[model samples]
Target: MEAPLVAALGALIAVVEACGAAVVVVGALSGGPARRARS
Candidate 1:
């Protein structure tokens, strides 16, 4: 009972961390192009 709940919470935390990393990576990649365009 409690074990399953703990596992679910862990998975959710992992997913959120992954998504945050992905967003940071995408933002970094796109920012380079925008900077070039500005120059």
Candidate 2:
């Protein structure tokens, strides 16, 4: 019982980290073009 709960929590953490990384990558890609256009 407890083991299953711990596994689920670990999986959730991994998903959150992946999502954060994706957001960072997208922001960096989009921000570069916008900055260049302004300059």
Candidate 3:
């Protein structure tokens, strides 16, 4: 039981970190274009 719980917690933490990285990448991409095209 404990092992399964630990695995689940670790997986959840990994997912959150991955999502945060993805969000940061997306924000940078969007901001770059918007800034460059600001006529």
Highest lDDT model number:
2
> lDDT of all predictions, in order shown?
0.98, 0.99, 0.97
Off by over 4 Å in 3: none
Tell me how candidate 1 scores on lDDT. 0.98
- Ten consecutive residues with minimal summed lDDT in candidate 3? 30-39
TM-scores, each model vs. reference: 0.86, 0.88, 0.82
Clashes of 2: 0
RMSD of each: 1.0, 0.7, 1.3
Top candidate on TM-score is 2
Instruction: Give the clashing residue pairs of candidate 1, or none.
Output: none
Residue 34 displacement in candidate 1 (angstroms): 0.8
TM accuracy, model 2: 0.88
Ranking by lDDT: 2, 1, 3
Q: Model 2 lDDT vs. the true structure?
A: 0.99
